[model samples]
Target: MMRTPAPRLRTYLSGYVLSLVLTVAAYLLVTHPSYSTSLIVGLISALAVVQFLVQLVFFLHISAERKPRWKLMVFIFMVGIVLIIVVGSIWIMNNLNYRMTPQQINTYLNNQGGGF
Candidate 1:
């Protein structure tokens, strides 16, 4: 019978350190606010993707799979689902924001006898 080898402590530790570094980096970026909002957000997003890869490789050991083809397909499907959900949520929120002008808000509030 073929047995899979157990993950070494070094792998876990590396994943932990990388996760910690990414978290701290993101925190520092937000707290310092040295860059433009869009740039900072883009950097954070990139960091998040890197952090996800670190977790998958070091912790999940996805790269160690004997049959990686199916795993890759599943991962792609999961990513697609996540993207759809995120994009749909953003689209809904943007549409809501577009519909709710400041003037319309004030008029609605006045009609409702002010301040909810």
Candidate 2:
């Protein structure tokens, strides 16, 4: 009986350890108050994205050989579009909400009351 090589096992173990570390870091980032909530959330989001890519490439083997590169590119492009739309909508809505004047608010309230 020949012994099987362990390169794949080593790679999988390393990837698992890195994933665990990333998970812990994300948890800590969300729980700690030393940093601003926005900053911590941004950092955690970035880290999560990086970790997801790492897992895809290292553990899932999502390469040209396993699947077509075009499929991966399309997936990434779709995700980018979704992120842009969501972030843009939030930013636009926040600005609109913050910039409402007292007069505008009163006018809306009056309109709602049938101009009473």
Candidate 3:
């Protein structure tokens, strides 16, 4: 049986430091609130993507694969599933909001003889 080489300590340390920095930066951005809401959200999202990449490379060691490509394929499939869930949730919420306005809710409740 072939033994795989262990990852160096520096990789983990770097990942930890980068993750910490990104978390602190995101916290500071939210707490300080110097920029516009959209800009802040965009910045924090960018930082989150960077942090994810750092975790993938340093912690998950996805780039260090030797033979099988299944891990990478699985990761991609997981991301797709997550995207589908998120988008579907958002779409469902938006549709519900559009369909159930305040007036509509009152009418619905009144029809059921339980309205305010």
Candidate 4:
């Protein structure tokens, strides 16, 4: 399909620059060690989501103009699955923490040869 190299290179460079900016922002937040852990985690997560969207649009070439929107549909499905897994894992861990007493945790740890 007689595509020009200049346009493709431009798209790639734009995506690369955006990705680099997001990565550096995340890195600064992590290495500074001034912010609280929760704040740093939240910032990093937001950066990750922005980077994901940039990759989807630029590198993957996903858009309404493209034929067969199934790629976008599949991506949505995969994202849903990932969100389910992460939410489920956090929910399970919270429930376990609530149900297990400190004494029980210590005893279980000792039983597993991780005694202090």
> lDDT by residue for model 1 over 13-116, one digit each (tens)?
99999999999999999999999999999999999999999999999877776653577689889999999999999999999999998888889999999954
Can you give the TM-score per candidate against the true fold? Answer: 0.73, 0.66, 0.83, 0.76
Error of 1 at 30 (Å): 1.1
Ranking by lDDT: 3, 1, 4, 2
Model 1 pairs in collision? none
Model 2, span 55-111: residue lDDT tens: 875686555233336657877899899989999999999999899976888898898
User: Candidate 4 residues 1-116, lDDT tens each?
Assistant: 42222237778889999999999999988988788999899989999999998987778767523555677788889989998999999999999999999999899999999955
Best by lDDT: 3
Per-residue lDDT for 105 in model 2?
A: 81
* lDDT score of residue 34 within candidate 4: 87
Q: Where in model 1 is the C-alpha error above 4 Å?
A: 1-4, 99-116
lDDT of 3 by residue, 1-116 (tens): 32335789999999999999999999999999999999999999999999999999999888877667678899999999999999999999999998898998999999999887
- Model 2: per-residue Cα lDDT at residue 86: 98
Kindly give the number of clashing pairs for every candidate.
0, 0, 0, 0
Whole-model lDDT, model 2: 0.77
TM-score (C-alpha) between model 2 and the true structure: 0.66
* Candidate 3 deviant stretches above 4 angstroms: 1-4, 109-116
Better of 1 and 3 by lDDT: 3
Where is model 2 more than 4 Å wrong at Cα? 1-11, 36-38, 64-68, 101-103, 112-116
